[model samples]
Target chain A: MELNLKLNLDASTLKADFPLLGREVNGKPIVYLDSAATSQKPQSVLDAMDDYYRSINANVHRGAYYIADLATTAMEETRSKVQRFIGAASPREIILTKNATEAINLVAHSWGREYLSEGDVIVTTIMEHHANIVPWHILCADRGTRLRWLNLNVNGNLKLDDLDETLDGARLVVLSAMSNVLGAIPPIRQIADAAHEKGAVVVLDGAQFVPHLPTDVAELGADFLAFSGHKMCGPTGIGVLWGREDLLEAMPPFLGGGEMILDVTTEGFLPNDLPWKFEAGTPPIAEAIGLGAAVDYLADIGMPAIREHDRKLTAYALRTLPGRFGDKLNIHGPADTSERGGVLSFTFGDIHAHDISQVLDGEAVCVRAGHHCAKPLMDTLGVTATARASVYLYNDESDIDALADALERVGDFFG
Target chain B: MPALEDLYREIVLDHYRNPRNRGELPCPPAKRAKGFNPLCGDEVIVFVEVDEGGRISDVRIDGQGCSISQAAASMMSVSVKGKTLSEARELERAFKTMMVIEGGGSPSSPADLGDLAALQGVKKFPVRIKCATLCWNTLSEGLTTE
Candidate 1:
């Protein structure tokens, strides 16, 4: 594979760090283009968890023993690492949950239920994964709050012309910073500012954005940010929910259990501090440590370089795929790479995405073929499903070339 | 890893490309059932018009999905049309039984399946068994309502 010398980041070299990327599938080297689903873990991240279990295997925050204290310190260090990773004010503002889904649910159940009332408006977008949308749906149903949508334009960008009107009387505005399907990077800062102007809290779904781009909660103007660890080369079963200090302090506890309570009483219980109030049970100790290592690994490479790589690779795909397939292929999302990330979603003729994916799999190329968990966006685009090929730091031009080469066979096989 | 050829048999592709009895039948005379594979967003709507003699006088398949799902529905429409309700049920049970068997079970009697035997290749790809069975499930639901 010839490396593109013009690229800022050496993806070929980066691929070596991820052990899974070195393996083969179907008798050929794997061309993994489904990073948006979940990123491949680096050896460092795997080793971090392995080391924790080997050396510091103990329960966190409860045991009085030296190993337990060490475990608790390690977990707290990861919390501080995450706090700095997203530029949160303090470690207290960062709450750990099962995944991004649980993070959003915590906000919906804790903050939403306490602040919102009947007839209150909660604004969201069509491009949201089911994680960000379903919680609000349940919240609205429970509280009798109205859910308003911010629709997308022809280019898959949010139509903000009616922003003030939509944000009118809205108590909260929830949306994704980067779309999982189209890789469209919406202007979150602009929307967040507008929501703040209307006194509506902005909840940014950073599952796609945090992994691929440089993120600062303050710069993005998000009041609460939610993202998963697995999507960013960290292990699964761990996610982050960063909220404003005051907001988290004011909200009621989400799950009432062991760690969340400061003192239990026969009558009532006192909730713990800012973050511990949200994290109910024994936390994901090693997983959080692994995520900290992932953060360190990404920081060593630098997010700016990663962002640049994503832009250049996405541009190459945006150009090469259509340039090769022509009218037969229809790439959905923004035509401008500046407005997009590394996610490439498209449809080819009448061929179902499943068939396209199956054909691609023959050559050891893995691509996601489904609605991409954005059914409202699928409805808006008039497609039941799309074949999505999302690039990550490990993917390069050769991978894209392999994808195109395999896609050509799809036309041959199905034509 | 089964070859794509095993899943996309020539007969399956033939049915997918040129689907038989495609479209909807009038509701007054025909019963309708819709099936959805929420995982992939594949939908199948099966409509059947049963005669007074308990025979499926007409059947039509309407929906969009992968070649496997669309082909399965198309083949099902052809196989059940003009057949007695009891005969269609027997075919559904036999087809489902074949799907569950590992490595595409060789039916005790291949003569019983006819072209449907080609779908036995589907069992090789476990995730896709749902795709092949979606139409039959919808048809079964429709028959139960009748």
Candidate 2:
């Protein structure tokens, strides 16, 4: 008989493990609904980072001392954890960078400069965060490449009706797995298949997607997959870029410095092996270990349960916000909860998003208000800004209720 | 410090709902300059028509933004209309003084900030202070531009 011994986890049990969750804001307990921005770290992640500094504090892969060896082992161990976390083929495919922004820049500078040239086409979606869109824009502007945009449908999902034509003669297709604004998870496999059929490489921005969903890079058919650790209950300084072994081997070093080199002479230098070649300088050592602990924590809770929790919270918000405010509250994105993640971006009546956020702040309700680093999506949505509330595993129905009650105050305050 | 009622004083909300001098003024004497709060994406356009003696004969504030910003602009337009450019500049300085406070605490000023005094509550909300200042900055920019 097979043994199943995973702990049955939910918000109440897991909420106690995070230190910040216990704190109060304005006399009321803080209802943290901004996980999409950055997740709250568990005690395990914090302890792991502190332990690394206390016991195994040393530079990695350089010093031959005992602590150096232990530090090196710990750092490299995080790489393997990350590879397994996302179901990448091997640790060699994972390149640890400063953050997702640096990861995208790595691909843009290394692969883009080598393969792309003037007049080549790069197709991207309008729903992308500036991180995914801006790098390609710089590449296009510099190389004189032509960039095409994939528009969104009326429901805020990508309108790939023109994918076949748009992918024609395209060199690369860059897009997000899930929109940070709309919370819509685009059909990544379908998009990857289409891009592959048109002989274009696919770069998937998984910053928002990987946190709430189970990511299998090889199965997703992405040549490059990027995500940040901070968004997934890890520290802010580290992020991952997973690439096909062949593609990574073909690309040049993103930043040339100490760790990324095998041998450096007065005249020239040879790059280091697979992942290290991309990780040029002193890496985010403690942060990587913390991310490894976060990966372990998530694995313990199980991604499926987390997904279910997120879905519940999202559905609750979707159902509650509409029922409470009717047409007065305009929540953007897909109507079906299954089609989207937990992010809810919306406007309440004629009140500006900043004002709504201010009123919400009074009730200790945390929601993000701005263009969400998605100006193109803002233009498409016909609004300059929206107040966004996103949920994670630790968020429960009570948090959603708090949000609803606070929103009522926002409406009344404006009225 | 995080009180909503303090920030949303009735006078401020009144100005937001029914702003004074809120449309475009006829040109020839009107000078318009735009201001933008890139973080909130709040925008304001300040138009001022100066008299022969460098006094503002008419002023109009137009834009889309939060209550604090729109109301600040509305109240600002009301205060500066028919005032000399130098007097308007003084009001702008006093308003800036009122908005800047240390550690989200209130700022003390011996001189009255006039109608713009209603916006001193914004000092408690540091993030919204930029929204409060967008109009005054635009008015300053408009006066200096020709």
Candidate 3:
């Protein structure tokens, strides 16, 4: 809540930072709680992207021309920046892709699809979004590998004790650092250690993790990590998949195209190198430059400060909402916010989540409703869907207040 | 805040509180169809018991849904009960006309709808369109089997 004052810039100044946020929706400023879907971009990121195309837009690594050289250099520079951002030891570990979904599919298609074979097990959890679930299903069925899952507790935390029991003979562990619906933070460090003892490489779907908390790949002990750019105040169509250098080097190329090839022959085409081998065809150049700007923007604020700010928002909502709505409101996820992000998925009596979202929309408060791409988790929660108000760096106490006020509207709407 | 009466109009609340024909009919005698709204997991199983006249004699619907959906189903089953196939189809066509984008997509005026006009307030909330149309689709799907 302290950071509310820190971000207390004038209306025009805030609009200057985010031009899109200035646009009125339903005759009011958009509160934009759908950051969990994708974050709004800062003007700095848009300007950075514009600067790239206007000055140095060209095909990467294909020409001797200066424009191409400039483009290629800026493109590769983002790789190093992302590597440092996640605390990976080398730039070679970061592979650029369209989004976290693509980054995950790359690993499943290239590395997991091949290395895994009959009876080899890949461990996951019911809490994963379908992006994490279906890919492994395809990989396992094709490769004859077995896909396993860790269960959820009544409070929605990953049942790690059950996870330990499932680890026997497991070759890979795929999990989200945070539950997308419940806002439960699984013990990544502990899960990684358990998987390591079992000789399994751990892969984290950090799409929910990287945006909320400070992420250090080495500290978390993940062999492969994937996250999208748009969740972290960057452009869509850009993401980073950080793997151990050895794994990427050994994994076959996911997509074969001009940017990723060393040479072509009637016999076969050889790959260029580690990062490029994963990225194929015309890359999202503007998005990557925008990602670099986003990295700069986040780093300037410092991750710990952002983490603490959201912790306060989550904690405050936990303390406040139950009293106001009483039995009419049921908050999903845990009561504690120290172990979670500011994703509050809740329901007002028997009101459907879409109706709750619509009522909120009328108040200029934007929250996400429906399954949030985590249907299995929704099943576990015993609700078809929930209305979720998620927060990011730009959100503050007033935003949370707006959310609470909107819920009162929802309660009346269904009365 | 708006008055509670303005938000939930008495009829909407009445349908929610006491939904009609709310339980399922046995599948063997009743022709049933399953409808799922992928946007949300609002699933409905509509069962129509057809008599020798080849008309819907007893339309019993079963499902779990949000208020709009459950109410719509509650309203729909009663509206079409014992109607001729032509009448039932007319209601379905009229419901779909209000729910989905119109053919060549002209916006629907409330005057075009009658008793179903109670649902026009729901049109303002685009997100709830699927909820308002769940039973209509179930009716559409169930009619095919009958």
lDDT of 2 by residue, B65-127 (tens): 888889999999998888998888877777787776323433355245777788877878889
Please give, for residues B102-137, the per-residue lDDT of candidate 3 as tens digits.
Answer: 444323564544556676566556666788788888
Which runs of model 1 end up more than 4 angstroms from their true locations?
A: A1-7, B101-105
Residue B67, model 3: lDDT of: 71
Could you tell me the TM-score of candidate 3?
Answer: 0.93
lDDT of each: 0.91, 0.89, 0.81
Where is the poorest 10-residue window by lDDT in model 2 chain B?
B101-110
Worst 10 residues of 1 chain A by lDDT: A1-10
Which of the two, 1 or 2, has more DockQ?
Answer: 1
Model 2: residues with Cα > 4 Å off, grouped in runs: A1-8, B26-28, B101-111
**lDDT score at residue A251, model 1, on the 0-100 scale:** 93
Error of 2 at A257 (Å): 1.2
Model 1 Cα lDDT, one tens digit per residue, B35-126: 99976689999999998999999999999999999999999998898899899988887888789743355556657877888998888888
Q: Which candidate gets the maximum lDDT versus the true structure?
A: 1
Window of ten residues with lowest summed lDDT in model 3 chain A: A1-10
Query: Residue A324 in model 2: shift from native, Å?
Result: 1.2
